[model samples]
Target chain A: ELVLTADMLVEGVHVPRHVAPADFAYKALAVNVSDLVAKGADPTLYLLTLCLPKHPEPGWLEAFTSGLSNAQADFGCSLAGGDTVSAEGPVCLSITAAGTLPAGKMIHRFSANPDDKVFVTGTIGDAAAGLALIRKEVSAHPLSGEGAMREFLLSRYFRPHPPVAAIELLRQYASAAMDISDGLVLDFTRLCAASGCGGIIEADRVPLSPAVSALLEGDAFSLEAALTGGDDYEVLFTAAPGVADAIRSAAESRGLSLHCIGSIVREPGITVVGRDGAPMQISRPGYDHF
Target chain B: ELVLTADMLVEGVHVPRHVAPADFAYKALAVNVSDLVAKGADPTLYLLTLCLPKHPEPGWLEAFTSGLSNAQADFGCSLAGGDTVSAEGPVCLSITAAGTLPAGKMIHRFSANPDDKVFVTGTIGDAAAGLALIRKEVSAHPLSGEGAMREFLLSRYFRPHPPVAAIELLRQYASAAMDISDGLVLDFTRLCAASGCGGIIEADRVPLSPAVSALLEGDAFSLEAALTGGDDYEVLFTAAPGVADAIRSAAESRGLSLHCIGSIVREPGITVVGRDGAPMQISRPGYDHF
Candidate 1:
């Protein structure tokens, strides 16, 4: 079966105008690959439609193509064809990716049962924190001012490495799946709604990187920000409780970290429990372009 | 076999800012369908990526979607899925169309033999004349103000009906084929370069609508403009001389008009001959976005 997904990135709306051309190109392809990965499909090819305001300066197109080539190699996909045209506004890029998996083997978003265990691959909220740092909405004092932690956070924001290796594990165990592009809580809520169920998130169990942990420990950032921030690009999925140990062992063998963050319930909405075992308040769900 | 093609259109660059939303939407899809038709494939599905500067006014989205829906019905293609986002500048649209044809039966642009005869579907230069009218670069006196001729020219510009019915004729008879988004001489030159041959076009044999003929008679437009103007959206193809009669009969049976305008030659470049049988000088080949 063929799986198709498209994503659009606009300057100033999705990324800052001063962003490195290579970084922008890499992320543009990576995000579409992330969607295919969530569907348990291997990306085959893609079409790139690029609209630029004017002729690029020397080295701009070279750097952009290099980044795109690197992404194609990393994701095991090739450029099939595309269109490039001049625009009268900011640069806009649209990539449509095609992938394939065995027939009837796709993981759907509405297949989770009420008792399914919710799982997420890798740490979340690091990219959101990285974006906040880039926007100067948060202080970098928690990272002791420009060390490995700061670099790690910034890399997460600029070049997201979505877990492409999780395809086999997901096809084997996940009953429902989606990628976390928007905030974890918001996207998870959507999954639950589609499945006609609710969920309970144990906030303490949500994974965090050392950088985000440091920010939280120093009271420089709140846990709510991590839960509500977008651009995670990690796989959020659900599976039967019986497959938890098997899934963990498989992830371990593959050098992937899997976390059991929550579970689906029969209720009609989501509830997030803090470490003290009380309901936590969420200011907003996720990113909304409109 | 699956056939894929993509195109991008930007506001203010491709069309005027005040262009009708419905026309814009219809043409966006039609242009992509034209590519499929040129390849002798039946369009099956498409993915759209739209970026807008702001939330549209109430009737804007409705009109745009209605036009897109109508085009889908006409072209026998459905929307698979897409992404819509906010842009910081002009509205940009990218459509990736997927089509299907029998394996090994697709027409190519690089297979024209030296003796093959070149043919084009429908009349040329009407869209260019319409664009000239829109830009106020040409007087409407030739069209005699707001009459059917005036409306016809504008319709050709805004709603290009690229010879969709010519697919069968091309697949059956064409040695080389491509759709003419650019002008005839320029696109034919590209085809010749790819096929490693040359072509000679008889200017008098080139087809034209009554409106463009009147413009030429009044000195408001030139035959050179018709030969070099872009946005014709007609199919340009080559076939062996032996199949010319068969191709014409087949096209006639299908109610599609095809005119033999030129012939491929052993030389390395193109030549245009006027009615007096003397070579004519061309100022420029076609439109170049960059």
Candidate 2:
């Protein structure tokens, strides 16, 4: 038996209340899978604990189970055992996934080194932009593809994908790695804390989808949202400088967009700079459960 | 690492609302540790997930943590990681405990023998009787020393002593086992299902505390409550009849009662018999979360 367990996601707290049931189901399992992937573990077994508000709507449970069963089939995991109970308010989904690693092969958060290259896979900030769009709060921009990108961004917010491959690949090449959950900057700060290293990230090198760029327009503050607004399940990792070529080639072969935007250093805090080397201060810190 | 996780308890569900917070604190961790003992797993780590109705009253969390810390010290376990969140209703504590099994020593529920002797450690129905006492619903009985027995029964309900020693003992001799959570009858039925076997239980042989007997008087209907009410946290197991002597002596030496009340049969359903050999109908079946 490999290390197997689960965490819970309450509806109003873990995910926003407006999320679709199907997306909620998919994201719930994906978030758990992301935990396993972060540990360089493959998902093999899962136990689902569901607390429903009422007798669940038949159609909703069907759709939710469809997403759950599909994810299990796609990931080659099996349902083991779990309990279901009634709750008075929000729906709660807790999944415990179990998987094994080869002997002596476990990656952790405290292994990054000074002088390592910091990389993130896939695009960032689209989910944040989508949230802004959903809230009807983002100002109009001069970008020509605003309409198309806005729809795409909104959809991305509903179905954030976990970068499982990027995380697994880095387990072999990266010194220390973690999935970007609480925004890139905040989570990177945590990685720094865990690894006892400092990092300097070039803001301009951060990957931005067209949707994010279109929403940002020329506003530097939009980047603050990119730095603090979470739900973009991308992999952020640090690798030795010597593996840079391999990292780029491996990501390219997988059609993953891997960006090296920062470097770890001997110091102990995170510093983010623009192209001109001016430090950027995010208006809001990362999401705090409290 | 061993798999570690926990679920929290809230007042009004696991305990009565009038119960002391201090008692609730101890019960929370004790119930979770019972799950570990059921698996014959040695406690190594714990994660506490506490949701509070409000910022806890002064010293409430402190007292809770003190109890949890004490339990950890008793079991040689330590905390790893956890999260605290706020809830609008009752406080909930969820604990995930991680434990280890020596190589090839992991116990499971699927290996019961057809003729294995069914045994349970410690007495049953005491917890249910305690609950009845708390509710002030038990019939008046004049048994001597009933007051002290009631106190002990109530304490057992409020703060179950998980059979940590029984885990090691059962691992040495038992073929299949699980902690009795949803009453002995219900949990044993589940065990039979898991092992694909049936059983014949002698009603008179089921272990009962004096308090439970006093509460029931002569009516055996209360036996159903004893057999099906949840939260006893005693270890129920099955082993070859040949080991009955060793099992009895081991439990006796430990000052714990090991009662052989049933025998797993080649058939496929649970059949309970009284002295007259008639079928007994239990009022409360095993707890069903669904």
Candidate 3:
């Protein structure tokens, strides 16, 4: 069987105007490859559609292709074919990735059962904090002024490491899965919605990186904002409680960590319990493009 | 197995700024489907990546999506998924289409032989002429003044009919194939290049719509432009002589036309034979984006 998906990145929207060309290309491929990971499909080939401005910077194409080569090497996919056209708009990149899976083994978002435990790969809110740091929207305290934590968050925002290695494990162990391109709260809810179930997320269990934790300790950012921030590119999934150890071991072997945030429920709505063990209201779940 | 391809449409490049929103959407989907048709694969799914300008017209999305729905029904492909983003520049659309072919049965452009005969589906230069007419670049006499002929040319430009019905016939007979998107002459030459052979094209045998013929007779459009005009969306293929009759009969049964315009040759370069049976020089073969 085959899995297909496409994601487009427009300058000033998905990538910052001042971002490095190579980083822009990396993010373009990363976002799409992340989708393949959710399906438990091995990333194989991709086509790139590039819309360029007239007389772009001399090194833009070279650097961009270099970045694409790097990601191609990282994700183990080849560049198949694509189209390039000149436009008067900001640079736009549309990458279509193809993944192959064994018959009857492709994972989906709608397979989660009511009693499945919700699990998330890697740290969730780091990319969200990374984005906020890049945009200067949060000045959260001495942490922003002191450690290399700011650079760590910025790196997450610019160059995400898509977890393609976890695909087979997820397909083998998980009941439902999807990549966290949108915020974790929204994407997890989307998975629940697809499976016709609900979730109760313990907000404290939502994993955060050391950088994010430091920022929170300095009162520079809030846990609520992290939960709703987008562009994480992590895999959010649910599986039976029996597979927890194997999921953790697989992620550990890859030099990454996994977290169990909460559990799937029989209800039709999500309840996000605060760190203080009380249910909290979320005004907005995640990003929406119109 | 799955076959994938992506093409981009940018304002003032692929489409005119004044074209209907629905028409633009149709063209975006049509171009990608054409590639799938050339591969002799059944287009089963497509992903649309749209970069829209800020503050687009109120009804634009509705009309655009309606056009997509119509084309989706016409092509028999469902919208699998996509991404939408706001751009600060011209509207850009990137569509990635997926087609499935039996294992080891997919057609290729590099498989033609020197003894094969080249054929093209439908009319070749009508869309190119349509583009010129739409841009007010051609003002050729009574033909341009005629109502039905003018609209015929314009329709070819805005809405292309991909040859989805003829895939089986082509795959069974043709050794190599590709869609004539960049113009018959250029795309045919590309096929020859890939197959490591040459071509001898008889100018008079080239297919043309009634509007194009009338334009040529009235000195409204040049035959050179007709030969090298792009955006035809016709399938160009090379088949051995033994199956020619079967191919022709199949096309007839489907209410479409086919023309044997040229033959692959042992030489290493293409020879464009004029109506007088002599070689002719092509100043500019087709469109090229740099």
Candidate 4:
């Protein structure tokens, strides 16, 4: 089966106005690759359309194309074609990626069983924290000033590493799968809604990077912010509980971290339980453009 | 074989800032279809990426989508998927169209032979004249004021009727094919450059709509503008002289007017001969974005 996906990123709205063009191009292509990976597809080709603002600074295009070249090599995809035009406003970039997989092997969000164990690849909320740092809403002072931790968070926002290498594992094990573009809770809620079921996430079980954990420990950040903030390109999926060990082993073999964060239930809504075993209140579900 | 092409349109750059959303949408899709048709492929699906300015006026999206729907039906293609995002500047629209043709049958602009006859579909320069009327650079007063002729030129500019229905005729007859987008002289020059040959166009043989002819007769427009104006969206192709009769009959049976405008030559430059049968010096060949 062939899988096709398109993504658009506009300056200021999607990224900071003064973002590095190399980072901008990398994130633009990575996001689309995330979509294809979530569907258990191996990305093969992509077409790019760039609407560049009038009078771009010298070397901006060179840096941007260099970034795309790096991304193409990393993702094992080629740039088939593209169009470039001058825009009167901020720069806008769009990429349409195409991939292929074995027939009937696509992982969907609506196929999770009621008793499926929810799994997510990599740590969640890192990219969101990175974005928060970029917006200056949060400080990296809690994590020992502007050091490696700060750079880590910012890099997560600029260059997302979606688990493209886990395609085979997900195809073999995941009953339902989708990338965590929106916040984990919101995206998991969507999966539940599509599958006509409910889910319960144990907050303590949610994986966090050392930087996020350090900030949480320092009382500089709230778990709620991590739960509600989006931009995490990690893959969230579900599988039968019987295959949990097998899935874990396969992920480990591929040098990937697989966390069992929640479970699917027959109930009709999503719930996040605190460490105290009480339900947590979410002020906002996720990012909504409208 | 699968064929793909992408085009980008930016407000105030590609179209007027206050242009109708329906016309904008139609032209976006039509231009991509023209590319597929020129390659002798049947457009099957398209992906649209819309970078809409923040807070678009009411009903703009509705009209844009309605235009896309109409175009999809007209072109026998469907919207596979797309992405929409808010832009910080003027609206920017990008479309990546995909088509399919039998392997080894795709037409190319670099395959023209030395003695191949050049043919163009339908009339040229009508869209360019329509654009002049839009920009108020020229007046329609010479063609009976704001009557059918006025509307005809405007419609030609807004809704380009690329010869998509002549794909089969082109595939069977043309040695080299390409859509005339960046003016007749410029695009033909590109074809000649790619084919390592030259071409000569007879000025009197270039097809012109009655509206354009009337404007020319009234001395309100120059044939040079028609030859050099872009956005014609008509197919320009070359075929061997042995199949000229077959191509003509095939185009006629399909209700298409195929005009034999010129012939490819072994020389290394393009020459346009005037009605007096002398080489005409072109002040400007075509549109150049840079």
- TM-score on alpha carbons, each prediction: 0.97, 0.87, 0.93, 0.97
Ranking by lDDT: 4, 1, 3, 2
lDDT per residue, candidate 3, A1-290, as tens digits?
88888999988888888679999999999999999999999999999999898788999999999999999999999999999998776888899898989998989999999889998888877888878877788874648445477778877888898787788788789899999987888898899999999998999988888788887888888787788888899898999988888888887887666789999999988989998888978878888766
Clashes of each: 0, 10, 1, 0
Give the clash total for candidate 1.
0
Interface quality of candidate 1 as DockQ: 0.85
Instruction: Report fnat in order of the candidates.
Output: 0.92, 0.10, 0.87, 0.81
Q: Tell me how candidate 2 scores on lDDT.
A: 0.75
User: Cα deviation in Å at residue A50, candidate 2?
Assistant: 2.5
User: Model 1 Cα displacement at B259 (Å)?
Assistant: 1.2
Clashing pairs in 1: none
Write model 4 residue lDDT over A185-224, tens digit each, in one string.
Answer: 8999999999999999999999999999988888778898
Error of 4 at B124 (Å): 0.6
Candidate 2 residue-wise lDDT, B177-273, digit = tens: 8888778788888888899998888888988887777766745227778888888989888999999999889888888768999999988888778
Model 3 residue runs over 4 Å out of place are A139-141, A144-147, A242-246, A249-256, A281-283, B242-246
Candidate 4 clash pair list = none
Supply DockQ values for each candidate. 0.85, 0.28, 0.76, 0.77
**What is the lDDT of every predicted structure here?**
0.89, 0.75, 0.87, 0.90
Query: Can you tell me which runs of candidate 2 are displaced by over 4 Å?
Result: A1-6, A74-76, A102-105, A139-151, A218-221, A275-277, B1-11, B17-25, B102-114, B139-150, B194-197, B217-221, B275-278
